[model samples]
Target: MAASLTAFAAAASADTLFGAMEKAYVTNPTLNAARAGQRATDELVPQALSGWRPTVGVGGEVEALISTQRAVVPEADELVDAVINDEAVSGNLAIELTQPLFNGFRTVEGTKAAEARVDAGRQSLLETEQQVLFNVVQAYMDVYAFRQIVVLRKQDVAALEEQVRASNERFAVGEITRTDVAQSEARLAESKSALVDSQTNLARAVAKYIQTVGNEPGKLVYPKVVNLPKSMQMALDAAGEINPRLLAQAFVEVAANSDIGVARSGLLPSAGLLAGGQVSDPDFTEDQNENASAVFGASFSIPLYEAGLVYSQVREAKQRASQSRIQVIEIARDVRRAVVESWNAYVGLGEIIKNTRTQVSAAQLALTGVQQEYAAGTRTTLDVLDAQRELVFSQVLQVTAEKNRVVAGYQLLAAIGHLTAPRVGLKVPEYNPEENYQRVRNKWIGTSVETVE
Candidate 1:
């Protein structure tokens, strides 16, 4: 199955937008890095969950003591040494446990905050995916347009070369001045230079295509027409509701607000249950034996004063929450602005594309008439050269306008948060960041980072 998929991908990437987008979806380094960052975020849930679970630990200690002893007989007048030296060894091994009963609902609020952050992280990953896809779209369009422009430049150079030859023939026969021939030659030189520049642009575009799509493009197929919102208001509405960055910011605000609760918990009382069992040998004396004991207790603490640290932390959290709330408003306004700008640009390019096509058609007709007039000696060499230049210029504009229209449409889609892999109809698996979050959210132990591909 993998081999077949690989073969299919190779064939598609050789000449299509879908293949390029699919390849970037699976292999782009930036997208993969963002996924990894999201997985790191998913671990926060498990860390928060640990607050509600008991902690168990095993420990052991060994000690040795040395001493010198002396005694005085009560009936005797002199003191005598009763013991020269004494040594004793003691060891203890224990297992201890603590389970939280309450801590002013800190765990509850912390878990809520963590879950909210994970939600925000998922949205952030979506935003990153959209960015990568949009970059691919722009890069692909640039290379395609430049490649077409290069072809036009080559055709222009060829036409100018023919014009120069004709001008030279006319001058040799005394039908035109040397100036006409020189003019044609100069125009040919300019066209050649333009051809070189076009080729350079094509090369640069190829390099960028490789970087963004993870493969060198073959003969690329133009991207399919995107589904656009019906009106500016509709686009704005979609962006307001679904724009990934805006949604992510909203989630961050929720997380920040939850943190206030977490911080306030520090000022309240806490309680926990503690239990332990120990096996010990207290001394090495012959009459001594090992002993075992068990202990169980509950602990409670009330906050007195700690230099006002908890109060300060609570204040800081509230301020941060306020900052986040402001950011949500800021992001919403930014989204609206982007939607408006992208909508206008895309709509304007539609008319531009139509106008450029009409210009190309008229230029082609004019060039044909000018060339016939030149053959009949009714039009000068200069007139023919001008017509050819106009035709090529119009043709170049047509190609560029088409490319820009497509790119502008893509940009508008991106602005409205609709340029997703599945939404755009790329034949690839969608990345589900939530799968990783669910996989690790309640884990208690071990360190395995393997998540869904």
Candidate 2:
């Protein structure tokens, strides 16, 4: 569908960052795969729940026997055949059921662990969604910034061209020297080369834009990243509370600890109810006679020795649980670092942009004054060229600063785990992974597909 959505206008492009985010939320392959993975994780709950349910099976078997025997009676002084040949065929049909009554609380703990894992899976998907959306933001911002740079480069070339023409005209009128004209021409050539480089950069940016957003971008509008934390402390708080990566790891720790209980349960007793009904006949091919039977009983077992298997498993689970606990702290530290870096970048770039704007303003005024002085024969051609160069450089720096500032804002939001479809209000359906999870969490005995890879 995105392939078919190749209309590259802002109108066709969905025009704004919100629109791009909405498109990506629905179409991005990475995000969709994460959703599918979470759905699979949801199945674990039902599987664990099945431990509390009954398993039934119906089966049958057939058998045939053949024998031959002969006996001789010595008293009668004669030999006689008693059982020369005998053949018999039999069949059996049975249905057996087993319902677990208790398993040392393994089912309860196993289900708890599975549910925690499913929760962790949901958090992981959230992180993935945040990542995909952030990438889209970065990609589109790159295109926008480069497009602005290309425009500036083109304007520089045009200004240099006009200066060259003016210098030549003054030289022809005996008002400027040949060296002055040559200098103007050289600057014009450099500007053209710079323009070419900027154009190439723009082309590369466009390619990346298409790859990221699943369509060529046209007429893109920069949308502001809203709902940012007002201070560093606020941001840190948000990261601690809602950062998906950190939360996912915390859930993983919980799941691991719960799994320890499941492993320990293996050392305890298990009990179940068993029932069976069967029918038998003396012949398999032909029914000569039949016998029916039904039976029900309680089964119980306690592990006496298992070659240290259960002990080893319990120890392994404990180690994993310890590792998971450490991982949660590790990931929290990482999230905090990301938040600090992104916050600083966002805050610092704002100041840099303000300074660059002032510089651009001064450079533009200086260039215009130099041009006027040159026209009045008070400034050299070199003076005019230098002023023009300073103006262009300042303008380029200003554009770069502005681009960085906008992107940094988004980066901060992403770092704190808030750059998501709902937060941005992208005017599209928010992907509720929970919907699928809820639908399938209690599902039994049906296989239905909702999407394909």
Candidate 3:
């Protein structure tokens, strides 16, 4: 187990988005907790089966006694029948068995309810896995986006500093007013402050990423480009059908419906067969005889009244089933809203990125022209400084637009429920409750954790 965890940690540090998602899929505490709860639900299956299977038990007892007896008679014929001091010991043993004959289908309904619970639990786990994967993707993209901003901010600061230097030269040569030099210096300081703010954002993103993935992301790689579906309606349609939250809600409704059957079964009679044998000895003697006997009998329990408890329970189950159905409709509406909101945000950012790219190209060309003119003494140093500042601003906008585009894509995927273990390229571990339950359910037991290779 240690080796496997170590390998997972290493893999988690390899990429910015995918790696964190994969690690969280296996190692996140919340997801593990959900899995544990689901396994607990699985035990109900065997518990329900018990109502149909035979129960057997063995028991033995031993006793010892010492006594003296005296008799008194009212007439002359009465005499001491005997006078004695004796020690006696006895032992008794028996095995008993009970099997269900009829149970008004209570056992069958219980089993069906248990199976429905198992299904609900499995869906809940899948929903939890989807949530964890979404969190990892968001954090990873946050780090990537902020890091890119930090780089662009640094470049902006550098460009502003060069602009300030050019303004100072022009002021010395009397080619431009001192006001231009002061404006340039003020802008440079603002650029420095922006760089500091960008660095702080980047640090926070990295910290969040580390917390989620359980390791620092080292030498991060760009996330693979995920192609959006052809249209927003297509994405919404796909999401409405496959979303884990919706699926989980559907299963909850199923479990609630099954509960109604279980509650109804409680109103009927139950029947079972029972058998037992026993042997007893009055005293421990040189010659001992063993006696054995067997008998089979059927028992029934009729439910006459329970102060309306069964009826109340049935009413409650029906109400819960109705509530579950309403929840499914609510979840579907919420999912649709999320799909539309995320899709719009993604498309808006894409447009900004495209426009910013064009602005950067225009600013770069303008800066080139200003540089040539300044070198030939045809333009003042202030002109060159202004052109360079515009170029730096354009570069910053382009970087921000790119980051926004990527982060929006992640959000869109999360909204659609596609951000889950298998969808995000993470392996899901298999869990078997029966195997673990059999190991500890019926025996005197202790537990220890051991590493699995």
TM-score leader: 1
Q: What lDDT would candidate 2 get against the real structure? A: 0.87
lDDT of 2 at 148: 87
TM-score for predicted model 1 compared with the true structure:
0.89
Give the per-residue lDDT of model 2 (tens digit) for 165-275: 998899999998999999999999999988898889888878876776788886877667699989999999998999888988998999999999999999999999999
Q: Residue 214 in model 1: shift from native, Å? A: 1.7
Regions of model 1 farther than 4 Å from truth: 1-14, 64-87, 284-287, 376-380, 451-453
The local lDDT score (0 to 100) that residue 51 gets in candidate 1 is 92
- How many collisions between residues are there in candidate 1? 0
lDDT of each: 0.88, 0.87, 0.76
How much is the lDDT of residue 437 in candidate 1? 81
Error of 2 at 151 (Å): 0.8
Better of 2 and 3 by TM-score: 2
TM-scores for all candidates: the values are: 0.89, 0.86, 0.76
RMSD of 1: 5.0
Ranking by TM-score: 1, 2, 3
From the highest lDDT down, the ranking of the candidates is: 1, 2, 3
